[model samples]
Target: MESAQRHLRMALDAARMMIWDSELSNGKVIDSTVKWFAAGTSLLGLPPGDLSQPFSTFLQIVCPEDRDHLLDTMQEAVDKRTGYEVEYRVQWPDCSRHWLAAKAHVFCDEHGVPVGTLGIVWDITERKENEQATARERELAAVTLRSIGEGVITTNAAGVTDYLNHVAEQLTGWTLEQARGLHISTTLKLIDDTGAPIPEHAALQCLRLKQAIGASSHNQLVTRDGRHVAVEESAAPIWSDRGELLGAVVVFRDVSHERKLSKQLSWNASHDTLTGLINRREFEVQIADALHSAKQDNHVHALLYMDLDQFKIVNDTCGHSAGDLLLQLLAKMLQTQMRDSDILARLGGDELGVLLPHCPPDQALLIADQLRQSIKNFRFVWDDHTFELGVSIGLVEINHLSKSMTELLIAADQACYLAKERGRNRVHLYQDSDLRLARRQGEMLWVSRLNEAFEHQYFRLYAQPIVGLCGHGGGHDEVLIRIQPAKGELILPGAFIPAAERYDMMTAIDRWVIRAVCRHVQSVRDSLGPQQAYVAQRQPAPAQYSVNLSGSSLSDEGLRDYIIEQFVEHDVAPEQICFEITETAVIANLIKAQDFMAGLKALGCRFSLDDFGSGLSSFAYLKALPVDYLKIDGVFIRDIANNAINRAMVKAINEVGHVMGISTVAEYVEDEPTLAVVRELGLDYAQGYAVGTLRPLSVSD
Candidate 1:
């Protein structure tokens, strides 16, 4: 018996447990013997002092909260005559709690009544502490995922849905219970921009690549309810502490509003805001494509450039509000005449362009005539006025023979202008043998010659004196530009002005004229310095040099600053300068013209509205311009001696100018009869050969 006990004690010592034996009576431990191992001593912080002690002494060290459970487990084991294992907390000598597991078997007699029990106990505190810490970390991660704004979904290594946050549930329209265990692609379906299902899902790609992945802006998420929502998505692989592939997490947000705004911006870039049609930039792109097709495929196409002939009359008569309505109505009417294969665009104000693909020149001419007739027959009514309209159409064939997009447009524009020149309503066709188009080509060549003149100082400045019709001495002279080539006759403004304006070269020419005029005025000022004392007593008024500005110069914001610089450089008085602008030029860009005129007028410079009695609403628009002189158009003055209508118009213009506190000047006064009529009309000034012929502008003049 002693050998058996010694072997059993050695076995218990090897396991680091303590062995205990108890004699039970009525479910109570009457006596017990205890054997302590290394584990037991470390747990209780005590050495084994006695081999025998009452079992009640050990119960005193048990945790008060667990003592009942331990006693009940022991009683059940004794009654059932079976083995029992129970884990309970124990108090050490320092009053610190530690976990203990007891395992034992109940010994019974033949009647199945328990008499004695044997058990083993060990310390399990480290395992219990680790389990509690792991539970806390998992709870924190779940709460964090739920609190975030972005939708988050997790999948397992097999790409099956494992978890989803509240935002994910809302976005996918699927509850966690319904999504769990399903393939991630089934729950988070994606479609491309074309609405084609994407086979490779972001989560699946992340799992396959074992790295992060992202979706493009064109990607969309399909919800459970069959709604497609634009969403920005990114996915990253979840990994274990040892770098093992565990799952993937996908985060996403709805980007529908952002994507919609982007689409709107793109549309606005290519379309005109007022007309809701493709703008000039987009029209040029289509024309370029047509050119490519003609060059590469030997295809034939046609382009029609149309300009409304009477649009300005309506606009100037009524206002821009009426003009805008007329344009919108005309656009709709023109669209009905176009085929599905035809492209129409608003090239600019009162100008529309048409592209007819696979159309020959003959068919293009017919279409152009039809459009012209439709416009000519249309009538526009605004407020209390009803007026007829007209259009000039230019047709140009596009084929492999076409030179370039720019040349094609220029040819079409030239033909359109030729149509207007030939008559008010007509269609002009551009061909290689067309004489008018040939003339246009000659004019285009002038663009280069004009540039050469600027470089080589081949330009000459002339002026004509504007004297008062009452015989008062006049010192104001209108400056005119002429191109004097090295070997040819002087080229008049009529020869190059139209071409310069067409090619947007007028602003540069205007600058040159302004600088030259300033320099001329300064030279005259220097030469007249000695004579100024005598002239100051006689002609107290300053001799103003009038320079004509083109319509294009009005929109040149830097022109104002540049003019200031030139005036300062030349040291010329602003009172000696007068800017003459035509009525059509000012009316074309009224706001810009007003601002330009106001800026210079503040500096003591004067403005003259040249060709004033031309527009249909001259009297109405006259009040809007700030000017010192109103130059009656030569059309009215050329026949004023005999034509009663011309005399009446001139009389009205002079009367209006006098009433507005602005001076009136008569243009094209070539003979004594015209001058006598101009003086009889009580006009302010007369500028023509009758008053003073054109002469070279020099300091000696």
Candidate 2:
């Protein structure tokens, strides 16, 4: 143990001496008096024997791969008398080889004869393996950097391009050699969405702050050919292992396709496919923005809700393909006439809305008039048949009085309704009372309630029998709608129907009544069959039960189809159904309504002109409507005995119906005298209290 300690101390002292001496040669220390390797002197795992033999045996213990080189290094050291260092593999006692570095210096006599050698052997196996592993990692890193799919670039602290991968070189049209060491701003240019240059120093600032920037920074890069390419890129500070900031690494991908797809999606979402106009949703957005701008700037904006008058006639007569073409042409015409700042949008169906920013009520009316004239002058050609078209416009202006976009639209819609009421193919401005009344009436709420009423079966049908006047027992019955008021007594059609028409709820109500009457006919088929058969010989087979249809419903493409489906489903003949459309509807959409009536008539269904003399009473429209009955207006009949004009009008209607082989029915014959007058006038039927009031005929009884 004492000897081992002494040897260990000697090894330590020798290592210290080698470390301190820079010029010591292999034999220089051998000739010195100080002992180098004593007999049986070994530190760590080295074997001790004859001192020189032990040292020589150490070199021979090197692995076969390194033995020759180690021997050559020893010979070189002895000949030159210089210090030597070499790393070689040595086999241990267990036959496992480990690497060692031997650094030695030789000490020599005056004639340069070798005396002794001093050396230190270090176990550098771990470090050597680590160096080989590091070399492998560097090679793998270079391959990965070049093989990356996305463009990659690295910059130094000065925002200069230090390295660029192959992809980066291809993206920028610059080779790695050309781009390296160039300022990043000069080699790789970035711009924003607007094609404005993005501050090149921004990335450097982020690196200096050791922060990360993601793709949202709008970094669009320009290629060498000046073609802009969309880029989604992220950058982060490149930091050393010890947390020292180096520069930045930016990785990016070309997003040109994605950008184009995004733009297409946006356009599709905001514009109508058929008309290439703004859609309802986009229209609302524009209106909201207009309202906001108006409020901020105290400017005026006009809203016009224009409905094509009798456009359904064109569609019904010419088919939807022609109708679509007409609409497209009308949109083009409107676009040609309107200012670029004004927005026109199809609000579905035959309705169109326009937003005119910075326009007042007077200017809005003028513009609306121009649109109306354009429509009136426009001739639509459907399969070589040319027809004139027109529009009824409702105009309203935004001011402090306007509350919301919806309210403004409603007001404009009411004004448009008034224009149609006054006679179509005209334009009217919204009155203050229109908005006030709409607000007070809560018309929209009523429309919603009407929908609920139909859903909940809250409506009832009341039949008024059109009794034969000349003691003839059989006559038809007209089904009238009776709406149950929310708070009070039941309301008749006269009281609520106008409101229904104003709000466009009449169409839905008309549908419900048609379905209801079909159901009723099915329910009472057995009881009413004989009576219907008796009346059929005198009138027409399949004795008609008149159900009034609104103008809106007549215009519905699905209406005729729906009614036909219901009739087929219920196994009811079409001849048993009589659709009563008012003279107003017939004249307003004469061509379309006539075609629709003709189509129904082709299916064996019958039609009647209800309230016959109420409208303009155009003989042309009456001749065109394909009607089987003419129900004289109640106003004329109520004053038939007192007013000569009313009597003459009723007589004229009766004469025309007779001449046309159409039955004439007089309505509102409240007294015996009025009924007697209607009978004397040769009217086919009379519907009033005096003409045998309605009775609830029960099937069981």
Candidate 3:
């Protein structure tokens, strides 16, 4: 018996078990009559005092959350007269809580009635803690998946859908219960940009490639309801801790808004916003295609370049808002006139282009005239004002004879210019033998030379003396621009001035003249001795330079500031310079010219209205302009001595000027007789070959 008890105790110590034995009566366990053995009492941190306690006393030590469960489990085991096991938490004497597992067996009497119970209790704190930590990790992973923005789907090794996050279910319109065990491709339907089914699912591809596979931007998702949604997706192979292939995880997001924005940007790049027509870049592309067809297939096409006449008049009379509305209206009207196959494009401000395929020059001319007449009849109304507008159309035939796209465009533009020159609201056809077009082509070549001249200092300044007729303002010279080529005679302004003005380069040229004249005057002043300079200052300034300004420059608001900067840089006096403008320039931009004149005059600079009597209403505008000089037009002055009508015009201009207290100068006095006529008219100044010929401008000797 002693040996058996010692062996049992050794077994219990090795397994860390506590044993409890309770006696029962009336087929139920009695209270406060329990036996403890093999460190049973020590397991719960209780003292051994006969080690017997009521069942209710033991229940008090059990954790409050586990007490009811433990009582119910024990009662069931006792009633069934069977064995059972349970796990519960206990609070020990030291106030520390731990997990305990109990296995109990019921001992019954011969009639199948429960009498006594024997149980073994052991601490399971560490094992229970490990299980709880693992559960927490799994729960955290699930919550993180639900919280993330990107839709996440995980598949098994066989490419079968095994798990789906909340986001994935929403995106695919499939719940986890509905998608489980289904093939990934069946759950997530993917198609290409063309709406064709992808050959293999991204998840399957990832499993085959054993690497990450990203779907193209063109990928789309087809929901169960037959709605297509743009999506960006990537699938990566999932691996286990043992480096074995588990499954693929697909992550995706919707990119519909971004793709829509991208398409809008592309549309904006090729179309004009104001007119809702294809822009110049797209028009040029159509022309290139036409040229290619003409070259390769021997096909004929026609191109029309249209320029709206009097567009500036409308834009200036009304505001730019009215101008925009007029352009929009015109674009719609022109579109209605074109055939379905013809392409119409807005080339730029007040200019448009049309490409007609399989049309000959004769047919194109009729069409161009139709368009011109339509524009001519169209009256634009803004506010309470109504204005009639016209168009100049240039038609060029594209055939095997067409050299290139650039040549075709240039030909069309030249034709359009000629149409405008010949009286607008008409169509001009391009011909190689057109002398006027040839002259225009020559002028286009001068544009390049003029740009080069500006860079290489090839331009020289020349002056023609303007003698005082009334001795009011003498020793003034009219400044002129000349170009000296590398190996030719000097080129006059008449050779390139028209091209410069047409190309919007006159403003730059005018600024250069201002700087050069200012520099020259400063150098001359520095050269003179102090006493001589003082004496010359007391007398009339050595010479006042009259620089001619174009109509474009008269409208330049920044020109005034630029001139002021030049004066400060060169230390030139304002009274030494006089700006010369034509009557046409003054009438074109009367308000800007008046403001410009007023600003400069306040600073002591002089203004001369040149080419007076050229316009029909010169006298009507004369009273409005504030000027110090009125240079009569050379047309009237060159023949004043011979033509009585010319003499009368000059006399009228001189009288109008004297009445306004403005000085008058006569141009083109080529002979002594003309000079006498100018003096006889009582002009303030006479400028011609008779007074002095063209010579390089220089400082006083």
- Compare the candidates by TM-score and give the number of the best one: 1
Write the residue-wise lDDT of candidate 3 on 398-491 in tens digits.
9988888888888898888888889988899988865466676777898999999988888889988988876665568889999888889999
lDDT of 2 at 512: 78
Which parts of model 2 are misplaced by more than 4 Å? Answer: 1-148, 200-202, 435-701
- Structural similarity to truth (TM-score) of each candidate: 0.47, 0.46, 0.45
Ranking by lDDT: 3, 1, 2
The whole-model lDDT of each prediction reads 0.83, 0.75, 0.84
lDDT tens digits by residue: candidate 1, 612-664:
86875556766776788989999999988999999999998889888888889
Please list the residue runs of candidate 1 whose C-alpha ends up more than 4 Å from where it truly belongs after superposition: 1-147, 433-701
Error of 1 at 260 (Å): 1.2
Across 269-328, the per-residue lDDT of candidate 2 in tens digits comes to: 988888999888898888887777777788899988989986899888989998888889
- Candidate 3, residue 180: CA error in Å? 2.5
lDDT value for candidate 2? 0.75
The better-scoring model by lDDT among 1 and 2 is 1
CA lDDT, candidate 2, residue 371 = 84
Clashes of 2: 15
